[model samples]
Target: MSTLNRISTPLTELTGVEHPIVQTGMGWVAGPRLVTATAEAGALGILASATMSLRELEDAITEVKSRTDKPFGVNLRADAADAEQRVNLLTKYEVKVASFALAPKPELISRLKEHGAVVIPSIGSVRHAEKVAAWGADAVLIQGGEGGGHTGAIPTSLLLPTVAAAVDIPVIAAGGFFDGRGLAAALAYGAVGIGMGTRFLLTSDSAVPEEIKRRYLEFGLDGTVVTAKADGMPHRLLRTEFVQGLEGAGKLAQLLPTLRRTVQFKNMAGQSWLELARDGLAMKRSSGRSWNQMMLAANTPMLLKAGLVDGDTEAGMLASGQVVGVIDELPSCRELVDRIVDEAVVQLKAAAATVRSA
Candidate 1:
């Protein structure tokens, strides 16, 4: 439907999309406008439901439906206190695909599959991929350490093939990918497709402020860094002065602001202290993080809101992948997807010509 060449793969087949590309659901950045644009472009555009309340998420889904009949997905936090309610929202709207930020429970996968919704969870390890495949997920999306936000240390080049080989389901690779060349490389690595977060966030369809977008464009490859100071876990972010400040500060100095943001995130997320505690307990059990780490984890939403929503770089933390260095312009989602697919077809054909059967 998107007026462009088609590059089909198992990803397109599994998700019923025209292109083997995914617009990742970056919190605050992946809203209705961006998702609608992506769907219109014939790629799977995932709405970031992790940063929304149940009401907001419903409204977003409704908005996208009104804009386009094309298929789109919603990204959910499997560890959320109301994950079941979120999953129910998808069924209520008849959402075509449901993606998770973590490995979802077996029953959740069963419920989604029973409703005929495709289940794809993001994993960082072969073990995670095998576990989810055994749970009957339709597919798996695995991001390497080169990805932004909370991430692992494994680079995608090595992780992609390993996971692709271990799972019977299709593998969609993420991290350090931005163009058709990356897509071609991913397909060669046995991936069915590629997912991109930073590249999509830099697009014209994204709601991120113009000032923030300009700042992102100025970053070189070394302009990004992975630091655990923000939430007591490895997080990839733009190397901004604010992040540097956090890195330089002692734990005692960081605690006060961390606690403050935690409360702010709680309020903005519409969760009471009791609900936060319940969610925190679940995170502890799953992640094995200390109470301090759990408390710091609450800082992510508000800090991201300050930078991404309120446009306050001085007080905000910006999540980004190393690919930010090579990206220099903002194109609409349709333009981006079309160019990638067209170029991928060329690259794939060119690669085929270079090899011969023995």
Candidate 2:
């Protein structure tokens, strides 16, 4: 099937985007280049800002705007010290959507919505989805445990339906989604669209290191593990030797190393210590994590940056989805999105034919 073939679904119109697929806001992974490309290719491309400085975030927004005229969103930590700055940038830029990494405050949602920006927060449970929908969020992205980074315990098969049945607003199913079959299945479950993180991270447009991306392709479906060691919350990541070591490092010994690592990262990134601490505290409070847990929470992104940017797999963590093993090659954003849509259309039509004959 031609990759351009698309599924006729509400997602195409609801988000005012061309496709029913979304490239989720992956911290440090999804940047201006990838976001703009995904948006231009007809999917919601969200700029991941949780790992960026306020200035870096604004520059990224500008970068994406420079690349594509299509509608795109910025993913922000709703509880950041500079959240106001990020929100202001979004409003000033007239960003079409604002996706929260964590459940943002109602006022934050209202503030962004007041500026004509649609609010969509990724949810891990039925309650989370329902609560946000009731709060007047434009939509919710329901992610399963199989998703990368910080994720909830619910499976997509169970969580998607639960959230869809409970909320009146749109829900975009995420986690374990790689191709059209997943999209068709999500739509069948009443989801307007499918959100993807690992799938996009493995794409040609993704700036992740070539070797690291290759490692993702080599792993199998069972290659991932969910661990709380990175942050206070559970996160999905590839089970590498370093990850195993980190996991075994236990909570006590991890603090000093993590702090040292964070300080080094700040230096490398040229961030002030005060700014780092401010962002860290904001992240901790937002996630309901303790101060110590917040300090530990800095490990995951640092690990990811180590592997993705520094070519040091042993020095960092590699957060990836379970779908990483199933992905064998890196295709351009257009090619990847088109292929999945076309494949889904063919699959749905074939199923329809079977029903008709029956």
Candidate 3:
């Protein structure tokens, strides 16, 4: 069967999106340009709204609409104080999908659904997937330990199958997926699609500095480390000296500097100190993390904003997936998506032939 034949569902059909692949909504990463490029390339590209101000977020949605008429998704923080406002912007834009960085309330889901948005949340565990599926999430993206940013311990190989078995909704596998073989593997494991983060970040279309992208290319698969110090939650990142230094320093030892950096980040991100602290506290409470962890958690998003938006390497954190090591060249979004789809088709066919021969 053709690779396209392997995935024919409401997701691909209703969205009018061609490929099953998705460019995940990465904070300070996936923006209007990247999202539009992905949608134009036939895959669903999700706008990362967690790092945006409410004004910036709306402008981004407008920018994406200006670029592509194709279907696209907007990634929002479910717990943000302005989440309702974000949802209102999504409805105004008539965005095809709304993906959540944090699990949202059922009422929020209902509100978005009523406005004709398909909801998908990134889940790290089966229980979370089941809960969201029951709550009316159209689908779930399962990112494994190999993913970037805040991630879970289960690898995609294990987690994808588990979540698929536990939930009735479609599962999009993520983490450690960088090539066609991985896409074929995900399909074999019953995932309807694959979501990519670092792979997309390494692409030429990404607005990140060339130096930063090169840094990602230099690593091997083992070069990335999952450190809890970036945020209160364990986050996958490139093993930079900054992260190593923070690791050795006790949480209390890092508090003052973290606070100082938080202020700087607030200014850089166009947020007030009060807003930043409030967001930090909200994040901590939602994650069930402690005060120290919550305070430290500010580092990741702030650093990411600095790196991507301000091009300040010293103050920025590069939250990259393990797949970063394997990506050597930066291809355009169109080239990357087409190559992945074509290669996945070829690979799946070859695997089928081997099974038939066997």
Candidate 4:
């Protein structure tokens, strides 16, 4: 049952985990239960904090700690108004790793490092990987265009080696990664490990409702679509009726619903109208998003919550990678990790034999 012998890379050494697999922090999907289970299973588990309030995040970190003594990470929105407070919380809790979706300020990275926490940021391009490395990031997670949620246009096969060669730090490959074959392929691409969001979300340990999980399993390789209609950013999502409707609808046609969801998200996240406006303004400045795009951004969290947390596929958005179509069953974290490791070892040995014969 122990499959640790299959891999030993800088990622496993840096994170102090037995395996180099990382369960990414998907908004509203990655929670304390799933994170604790992944950590216990010997992979790095990152708790998604973007959807949680400051108090909620604190409680979640404590809960995960209570559940497992193994090391784990917390993913943060570096652009959040309370980013500083969240960093302090990580320092206070003595969390092992701090991950960011957007590049954090150099000072923030320094602060985390000072507090004895490893800093890893998810990047979509080679330049971004280089920038974070120069800013002293401990590691970088690179996600290709095939990743779920907001993604870029580059495929992992192309992006991985580009970024891996661009940075001196360890690179973790993500997007379209589901099984042991992917693990072997990523390693061949010079990545130290692989990060998986959709694969982990479909696991038995994930808190997503069973009905929604079943819905996800129904998708084929072509069951997903990349649309900018969701948040004015290219988002990879399941090709549900709701998504098709969004694709066909005009901007004006979608405006009213987007605004309503905006208000709902504002309330759910416990942000005042003024605070939401300020965050929107910050996003606009940082990302160079137009007014329309910024307005649409408000709809993302609520829509995700509806589908992932409430099991309302008709009205909610399911952020997923293209790999969902290929995954057919839900395995517990331990079983899934062990299976991948064992399979990877077999594949590597077979390849070595081929090399010898050649």
**Highest lDDT among the candidates is held by which one?**
4
Judged by whole-model lDDT over C-alpha atoms, candidate 1 comes out at 0.92
Stretches of candidate 4 exceeding 4 Å from the true structure: 1-6
* Ranking according to lDDT, highest score first: 4, 1, 2, 3
- Judged by lDDT against the true structure, how good is candidate 3? 0.84
Give per-residue CA lDDT, model 2, range 1-358, as digits (tens).
2255656556666567888898999977899989988998888899999778778888999999998988899998777777888899999999999998768888888999999998999888877777787788988898898898888888999999988899888889999999989988888889999999999999899988888888888899889899887776788888999888867886678878888877876875577889878877777656778887777766666777888777688888888888887899999999999888887888888888999999
**lDDT by residue (tens digit), candidate 1, 128-230:** 9999999999999999999999899999999999999898999999999998899999999999999999999999989999999999999999999899888
Give the total clashing residue pairs for model 3: 0
Better of 2 and 4 by TM-score: 4
RMSD of each: 1.2, 1.9, 2.5, 1.0
Q: Would you list the clashing residue pairs of candidate 2?
A: 303-316, 303-317
User: Model 4, range 92-121, lDDT digits (tens) per residue?
Assistant: 999999999999999999999999999999
User: Please, what is the TM-score per model?
Assistant: 0.98, 0.94, 0.94, 0.98
Question: Which residue pairs collide in model 4, if any?
Answer: none
Q: Candidate 2 versus the native: TM-score?
A: 0.94
Task: Answer with 3 or 4, whichever has the higher TM-score.
Answer: 4
**Count: clashes, candidate 1:** 0
User: In model 2, where is the ten-residue run with the lowest total lDDT?
Assistant: 1-10
Candidate 4: what lDDT? 0.93
Candidate 3: pairs in clash? none
